[model samples]
Target: MSEFGRENPQFYLTAPTACPYLPGKYERKVFTHLVGEKASALNDILTQGGFRRSQNIAYRPACEACKACVSVRVRVDEFQPSRTFRRIIKRNADLIGEELPPQPSADQYALFRDYLDMRHAEGGMAEMTVLDYAMMVEDTHVETRVIEYRRRGPDSGIRGRGRGPLIAVALTDVLSDGLSMVYSFFDPDMADRSLGTFMILDHIERARKAGLPYVYLGYWVKGSPKMGYKIRFAPQEHLTGTGWLRVEGEDDAQD
Candidate 1:
């Protein structure tokens, strides 16, 4: 790990497991550990090269004979919201997003627990304990921020912090190319507001304001309905065998 080796970080592959996105398929991952001062730089290179971060680990799908997992990103400066997206934005108008230090608290953990129970009960992160949640928030080598979305409170504008029950949370990484959404979750009961889409839209706007050109949306699985929303953001780029290509006029293009 000491030698830069053209800035290549050490990599390892995980054992095959049941693929959550695509049924009857096995999925493995090629991953690496991000630690020390160079971790941030390493993370940026890995993300640009198709890896996604979960805590200190950077990984990407490596299923044999399948390439359905394609990295996607919204061209922030050129993004045009669809009519549905606009509606979602309007629906969540009462919520205020406060960008705060990446420090996990009891409230965030409680919301995280509820989100996992409601949305991903059978998923891999279903069993993450409070300690795990804290590490997920605070254990980082890159520049990260936690954006907490809550109902507008009287003192929200002055204090710049959410006071009501947490409705949504996005742990984001500030990268040179764009803002990479490391992970995001919201109250599943509030599905009508489409908090998932709202968070992505917010990230796109935030990126545009910061002069970044893209908002990395991680991977979009071709046949996974759970991942279908990634295609809704128009004028996005999908990383293909050739390179990043603009998605054309398909409403729900798969990865």
Candidate 2:
């Protein structure tokens, strides 16, 4: 093959695995590697086409006779926070998000461990060691960032950065069109503050300021409680056969 032909990504299909979100269902994926000098541009195209990034791979669900996983993106310009979402934002107002390089830290790992232990004890990532967490943070060829949420320090306003203990972290990919949240974790102790929802809200604001029109939120699986909060971010669009269809409210969202 020519250099150009060799550089083209070859897709692969994964063996079926038990679905993490849905009970008694198997999930399979069709994936491709996101590497080489073209990775960033390729990431943008793949993300827009409903594939999600994991390390150096881009994948989307390809299970036969099942389509529960629906890719969704928030419409930045049209988004209006609901009363509960507004409360989540206010509850987290004391926190400030600092965008940093995709480098892992001991503090982040500690919080990640705590989150998994408390919230996802039986989940697939429960056994992930520090090294695995590090790879999750750093193993990427795409344009990526690690956002650390921490309590505002005395000089935060002057420095434009937060200080003190880390409360949450989001692994995000900066795409040509929007910010794609690859993965995220938070301190389980702060669950009442709804840190997950807060992060998405924060990303929406960040995208708005940067003139980006969407915040890609991966998949929103119907009937999965774990995926329900996603649909609450109204004025969002769901990837469908006819392209992205706008869903204005929770009731409007469909499988």
Candidate 3:
């Protein structure tokens, strides 16, 4: 009889586990499945409320005594690219991104596997199989798109899609406020380009072009080196206790 309907989403709390983002701290999550006909609408509301989607699950950190996972989103219109960000764009000038339907491909799976093996070998998703990868891309009922990045070729102008080997892929959700980058992966060998940062810069630009006000970047955990780069993007807003607070000093430890 709850508002979630017959296919009611059953919420559960994860047992406390070693924090992946912080040392000597534990982390927990409150999660629910995002399925059924109302999935898309439910997803939108949850995302705005700081939940992140993975496959068919919507989860948000719910640590008992810690609130280190702060959701941050860039205000696209007000974002001014730093010199480094501009250089990143210049360095990747030969690349092109094509937005396509959420269909799984062997090439994508290969790249995904390579990324996991090289970057997140010990992470939870390292054991994901090909079928799991497919479900990750196709299990969503929300408005999603896969952006494939590749090098430009002779026929690039005509086809509009890039032609080199698949270097990166981003699973994005189109929302009323902005685009949510659910997950993205790049070739680890191309570390010099800093593809991870480059992708984020690209998304910011993309949001601007699309006339969206913000580009949701999931969460930023303070004291976590892996998540430190997120603070470098100036003019970002963090979801604080008082609501979305404009963050000025990158050193402010909200998370």
Q: Which candidate number would show the highest lDDT if scored against the true structure?
A: 2
What's the best-to-worst order under lDDT? 2, 3, 1
lDDT against true structure, model 2: 0.90
TM-score per prediction, in order, is: 0.92, 0.95, 0.92
Best by TM-score: 2
Writing each residue's lDDT as its tens digit, candidate 1 over 18-98 gives 898998888999998887778888888888888899888889988887899999888888888777778878898788889
TM-score of 1: 0.92
The better candidate by TM-score, 1 or 2, is 2
Kindly indicate the candidate among 1 and 3 with the higher lDDT.
3
Question: Clashing residue pairs in candidate 1, if any?
Answer: none
lDDT to native, each model = 0.86, 0.90, 0.87
- Candidate 2 lDDT over 42-119, as tens digits, reads 899989899999999999999997999999999999999877778878888899998999999999999999999999
C-alpha lDDT of residue 43 in model 1:
85
lDDT of 3 at 112: 98
lDDT of 3 by residue, 1-255 (tens): 356542677889999999988889999999988777788888888888999999888999999899889999998888887777788889898888889989889999999999999999998899999999999998887889999999998888889799869999999998888999999999989988878778888899989999999889999887787788788787989998788998853633221
Model 2 residue runs over 4 Å out of place are 1-6, 251-255
